[model samples]
Target: MSAESPGRRLGLRGRVMLTFALGAALVLLLLAVSVFTISRGYLLDQRERSAQRLASADADFVKRRLAAPNADPRAALMALDPAADTILLLLRHGEWISADGNPPPAPPTPSLLAEVAAGATTLEPVTVGELPYLVVGVPLGDGDAFFEFTPIIELRSTIQVLGTVLAACALAATVGAALLGLWASRRVLHPLRSLAGTAASIAGGNLDSRLPEDNDRDLNTIVTSFNSMVDSLQRRIERERQFVGDVTHELRTPLTTLVTSVEVMHRHAAELPDRPRRALELVGSELDHLRRMLDDLLTLARTDAGLHHDDEEPLRLVDLLDHVLAGQAATPVDADTDGPVLGRKLALVRAFTNLVDNAERHGRGLARVGLHAHGDHVLVEIDDHGPGVEPAERERIFERFATGRTARGSSAGTGLGLALVAETIAAHGGTVHCTDAPGGGARFVVALPLDNTPEDTIE
Candidate 1:
């Protein structure tokens, strides 16, 4: 049998119902067999006793009649059974004679007659053609014997009906047990289903989702443990977010002061020595890099804390791409693809800028940026002509601070560009991924849903 057979593939509820049905069927079958056996035995025993008694009375009458002077044994035997269905016979002088003046349906076998003539009583069941009969034989004083055949068709019919009824009752009991098992399974697994739903809600970012209070002690323990674990996880996340937020907030003031001092030094650079002037320029560059990293960190922390909201509005896609690529050296291959998208303009701009910057820093420079409509969404492609990303690192490169082999040895980027781009696109109910570009290098594709209703809003 295959692994996915009907019996193996059955769910828990179905399996439970099957188990109950089989158990009930086995028990009912055994009970029905026992009842039928006992009832049939009792009925057959009673029937045999009645046949024996009737035969004995007839045999005694025959004996008395035979003792009388010039008595007719056949006449006495015939008078004992008025019904034609029953036959009486006499065995004497090695000849068979029927008392009713009719041939018996089945005559006694020689062995039976020999036993009767030897002074031993013989009782046997026999079938004559298709009819059933019980035969009883009694021996007489002169080596003669008397026999009677009783039809038992009615008794056979009764037992047959009883057997059918018992079988039907067993089937009904099995069906009832299966239905009861189904009800019990549903009732028992209801809480577990609810727990699964609650876990799904939490996994989907609804961390506040929790199981309802249950009075059942067995269920309450599981609910309490799950809720406690979620509580601890939520608290730990909040603490980490708060730590990032605090550090970023504290660095802002000092960063502002440092930027102002750097600008002042740059204004007076004409008077400084050449080496010191170059050093000041490097300091200014480092400060700018530090400031951008801080900003990226703050943005991530805010997103984690669910503090930022998208201001969605209808905006033309062609105009958005043009505005973002105005000063960049990148070429727009199909910026004329016209469509109005409902989104936050500022966030979309940031996301597009990050993609273009990522291409410039890691893949030499942006070769082309294109936009086109595809089904219910718009596709944006940013192609770069430099050495493409390795297939193994394609997905990992999108994670925060995840740099590729080429960028790892250099300080060209803070490694948060593609990560932010992924987050921002995801917030707009879109998806982003990288693949090998046509001819060479890497291509980043972003797909944004065209019908951006309020229900798709991201927090």
Candidate 2:
């Protein structure tokens, strides 16, 4: 990247997709957090309720069992410790029996026990061996009593496992949400990708490339706007080029006559008085040069406008060459085609005549003029015997007003000559180039497409 770089980094498609993905991801994260918070809280609340219910139910069942007749109350109480981690205590007539499991340290004291003995039920938090427990006490038959205790450690362990599982689920959901976000982003970006590609093609010089019509109004507007702009730009540029060419061509003939008349007058002006004649002659020569320039400009304009007359009919290159080269000695001018070009006879004559004239005017004589079939085109080569144009100057000379230094002094024609040749060849859907001739000097070759209607050929 240079300072002149086009300044586009992320294309429209990529930017659109990234935005979509980020939005989705954010939504997913919010949803996951909300769900995890509510669900985890609900699960823990339910677990707490279940722990309380189990403690109450076990206490009632043990009480009932101990009150039965001959129940070997101690054994009955021990039976209630299904997990073997349960603690049971029986007190009768001031006597106490402890089970194998250590009793809850915070069991009711004498005063609290007295209250229970007086037919009052008690359920309260207690501590045993530094561990918290839920203690439930109940009155027994005949002044005896029962106590049941449950440690909170088991409940804590269960909650820890549940918490772990919830956390894992939340982690997985977050990851899944990110992937979903990416997928959605891609869907939203597909059309943008198409738009970007079309834009790039147009920027690279294919003005005809356009985005496809889409039903989505948001994207449809963009595509329509871009296509419209391209259409207008192409049309405007073409019109400007045509206007310049036409103006140049329309000025040629008048300028040529003016310059020619001035030159003839100046050649004979020596017979008259010096001062006025010399000045008039200078004006005439300058006008002649100006006229030649105008003619070259007009030729270029016609080529650009594609307005050259081309009514194709059978016409031999041999005869046309003879007429064009009449009164001038030709080195070699041959027609190798099996048939005449299928185009406006006059325009073809002018095109080839211009090339021949240029060679003669600059090289002092025509070297050769011939045509050959190449691929799907016809190659017309005009060879001149003067010192060849340098490779560097070949392309430059085809520009407006360019003149090769060696030939510049000898020829008085406008620099628009080769520029016209290039444009004319292009108008006919063809190309022209310069290269080395077999016998030396320079060879100018024009390749014309041979397909399509003969009359449709470029003038």
Candidate 3:
């Protein structure tokens, strides 16, 4: 047998409901058969007994008529009446005779005839033409015999009505089971739905998200375990962020002093020789790089620790990118579409500047920049005319502390620029990724959700 997915097969609730329906149908069918059998047997028994009694009485009267002077079998049978829908027949001197001079409705079976000929009374069910009848045969002395047939159409009708009622009941029970299954399934799967929702919230950066308490024992076990796991993860992340924040705070003062001291040294650049001047310049560049790296780490730490301010506002994507590029070289931009996006102005600026800076430092300078809207999102593409990002490195490029060669052969980035870009964009409910740009170069694409309406609706 071929394997199939769980979704393709009948679901749990459907199976449960089907089980109940099938079980009820099987049991009801058995009961209906049994009841019909018993009732039919009982009714047929009473009918046969009553028929025998009436036949006996009719036979007694015919016998009396035979005893009379000039008596005739045909006349006696025709004259003697029994019940409605009953046919009488008489056998005298090896000849069969029916009342009304018509064909007999039912003739005794050979077995019944043999039993009756042996001087014993017999009763058997038989079909007369298109209808059903009971044949009662009684033996008379001197090779004489009598038979009676009675129609049982009414009894068959009653049984039919009974069968219909039973079938209807089975159908009703099945429908009720389906309704019950629907309700029970929702109740049974409610906890699972809650778990999924909480997990989604956490994935969206809500570390405090937790499953609520449940009353069911089995469900409660899963809830407790999931909540405990989330709590542990949250605590570990908290400790790590706290350590990063503390370290960055400690380094800030010394780093500022170093930069200030370097600026003072650059003022007297003419007195120094070429070698010394170059050496001083290298120190200042390294210091600047270190300072940028530390700042990126601190921002990440604060964001993770939930200490970042939410001073967000609505801003246009075109304006945001234009301001970032205006500080440096000219770049092509398409500003035909896209609405404002909700974000912090400083954070958005910082992330966009990092992209431009990374391009200038590593990817052989920015080749082209494009901006447009797609559906409910604003897409920003920054292209560098250098060897594009490797397919294998595309996803990893966004990780913190991830270092790799720029489009150029040299690895000159702070290793945290793209990471910070990804983090900041994600904070604004956006995404950033690397791809191969059109015409063979690297591309950094950022997509932020469009905020078309006001910051908050007011009536």
Clashes of 3: 0
Candidate lDDT scores, in order, read: 0.83, 0.67, 0.82
State residue 374's C-alpha deviation in candidate 1, in Å. Answer: 6.6
Total clashing residue pairs per candidate? 0, 11, 0
RMSD of each: 4.2, 10.9, 3.5
Candidate 3 per-residue C-alpha lDDT over 256-353 given as tens digits, one digit per residue, 9 for 90 to 100: 99999999999998899999999999999899889988988888787676565557878877877888999655685767774788888888888998
Error of 3 at 383 (Å): 2.6
Index of the highest-lDDT prediction? 1
TM-scores of all models?
Answer: 0.83, 0.48, 0.86
Instruction: Report the error of model 1 at residue 379, Å.
Output: 4.9
Model 2 misplaced regions, further than 4 Å: 1-222, 238-270, 274-282, 312-323, 326-329, 339-342, 404-411, 451-459
| Residue 129 shift from truth in candidate 2, angstroms | 60
Superposition error at 274 for model 2 (Å): 5.2
Best model per TM-score: 3
TM-score computed on alpha carbons, candidate 3: 0.86
Q: Sorted on TM-score, highest at the top, how do the candidates line up?
A: 3, 1, 2
| lDDT tens digits, residue span 1-459, model 2 | 566433247554445555655665666667666776776677656654654466556656766776688766556566664444556676756667666544444556776687777887665656777776655566765787766665667665665766676666666665665566567667777787887898888665466788889898888888799789888987986788678875765666566677677767768888779898978967876676776676666656655555666645555455666667775664556556633444555666676777777787876567888777777777788888877777877777677777647343454667777777776666555778888788888888988766444644422
TM-score of 2: 0.48
